[model samples]
Target: MGKLGKRTVAAREAFAGKENLTVEEAVSLIKASANAKFDETLEIAMNLGVDPRHADQMVRGVVGLPNGTGKDVRVAVFARGPKADEATAAGADVVGAEDLMEIVQGGKIDFDRCIATPDMMPVVGRLGKVLGPRNLMPNPKVGTVTMDVAEAVKAAKGGEVQFKVEKAGVIHAGIGKISFDDKKLVENVRAFVNAVSKARPSGSKGAYLKKISLSSTMGPGVSINVDNAVAE
Candidate 1:
């Protein structure tokens, strides 16, 4: 076997026997072990008990991280006339109407978040096949579809993160960056957890939050104690 790289070896040793720690402890460990050359995104993955296959059990929502996500979020807006101008004035990276749809149809989706005014749904609806799978489809429930373009764009560019449960009953999102203060990271993690908790569908029966894990982009995951993670 090839010798383990120094960073990899160090990460492994740092994670050994570390599991089911409190949220604060887990975040501290992940932050310390994230010694990558570049600033790494601090990611959180939650194993929930709901099945997305069932319509009523689907878990999806958005949360604004208090400390703001350290990454620059690219936003694409689909609107016409005044709404288009509103989107642009709000710092939207890409704003357009049918032309934007044509670009997306050509498989050239270049933005991370997609937003659309209520009137533009008819146009955006046509691209559901393209955006739905990417989880970039705008939804009013998540504040991505709205008439308030300015606030939506600002929120998207700030630290708002959208999360949807996968087929495996898991939801994952980057809460902050490794460089964030431990207190800020902990606050962001708690905020995200609370949002998911509040979005719990009526169909959920057992323990809603099954597992919580925190990790940096290049580090090993550290399991966080579910109770501590979900506590307000």
Candidate 2:
């Protein structure tokens, strides 16, 4: 491995010997050690006990962070007529039908979130190979595929976050930015954890939430006490 930078080294040293910390403590440590050029995103990772390969064990859900994700979210919507206009008026960065599909297919996916009205699915469906891999497909389960385009667009721009357990049985997402107040970060962390806890799959056995951790874009991670994280 290459030599560690000063910032990385200090962050690692600061997190040394820390484990199973309360949500508040974990957020504080992560925020303090986030000494990067830009405002680093505060991220959370939960190790779930479900094997997603099994349909019954899959875990997926969305949560709107109380403090909002510090990053601005660009939204794309697939709709026509009033729904299309509603999405645009609701601050969607891009809205369209086949025109939007052509843009996405042309390798110009510039949006962070995507929403689609039911009627537009046939057009959006063709881009499954393009959007599915990036987890940007509008799925009904997550409320991205709905007739309520305005609300969906608003939510996407207002800190809504979707999370699905990966093959490794881990759910990861950015909760906020290190620059946010400690209290806001704490609230976002708990809200995210609770959402995941509620999304536990039926086939999940043993301890559903195995572990939780908090970290910054350029900092070392700190494990959080599962009970403390899950506590309301």
Candidate 3:
């Protein structure tokens, strides 16, 4: 059997016997254990109690992390005329109409967040098969499809994060980087939890938030108390 490295052993020792800790404690533990050469992203995963197969039970929404995600979000906008200019002026990395569609159709999608004007949906809809699977489809519910291109671009470039529950009823996203201070990380974590709590679908019954876990890019995950995570 291959022996565990010293860093792994130390990380496990630090996390020993620590289960279901408060949000703050879990963040601190995760940050401390992140000793990788690259800046580690602090990720949060929440197990929810809803089957997304049913339309009404789907859990998906956007939240502006109080302390930014500590990562640059690439934004692409589908618009024309003044709206396209507005997007470019607002710092959209890529902006176009059918041209953007062609780029995506050629399998050269390079942006993270995608936005679209209401009129551009006809063109954007054609790429649903490609973008939908990547969670980059523009939807009004998530503020990615609207006439206000500038604000949307700013929000995307800012700390706004969109989360959608997976097949296993789990929602996961990186809240921030380990380089972030403790206060910022805690604030971002709480903001995310509160957003998910508020997005609770009516179809969901008991225990909407079943479990919450925190971990760095290269470290082991540590479970956090659901109650503590939901507390304002």
Worst 10 residues of 3 by lDDT: 223-232
Compute the lDDT for candidate 3: 0.95
Error at 69, model 2, angstroms: 0.3
TM-score of each: 0.97, 0.98, 0.98
- Better model by lDDT, 1 or 3? 3
Model 2 CA deviation exceeding 4 Å by range: none
lDDT of 2 by residue, 1-232 (tens): 9998888888888999999999999888888888788999998889999999999999999999999998889999999999999999999999999999999999999999999999999999999999999999999999999998999998999999999999999999999988899999999999999999999888999999898988898788889998998788
lDDT string for model 3 (1-232, tens) is: 7999999999999999999999899988888889999999999999999999999899999999998999989999999999999999999999999999999999999999999999999999999999999999999999999999999999989999999999999999999999999989999999999999999998998889999999999999999998898788
Residue ranges of candidate 1 with Cα displaced over 4 Å: none
Could you arrange the candidates by lDDT from highest to lowest? 3, 1, 2
Give the range of the ten consecutive residues with the poorest summed lDDT in model 2. 27-36
How much lDDT does candidate 1 score? 0.93
Per-residue CA lDDT of candidate 1, range 202-226, in tens?
9999899999888999888989888
Write down the RMSD of all candidates, one decimal each. 1.0, 0.8, 0.9
Give the Å shift of residue 29 in candidate 3. Answer: 1.0
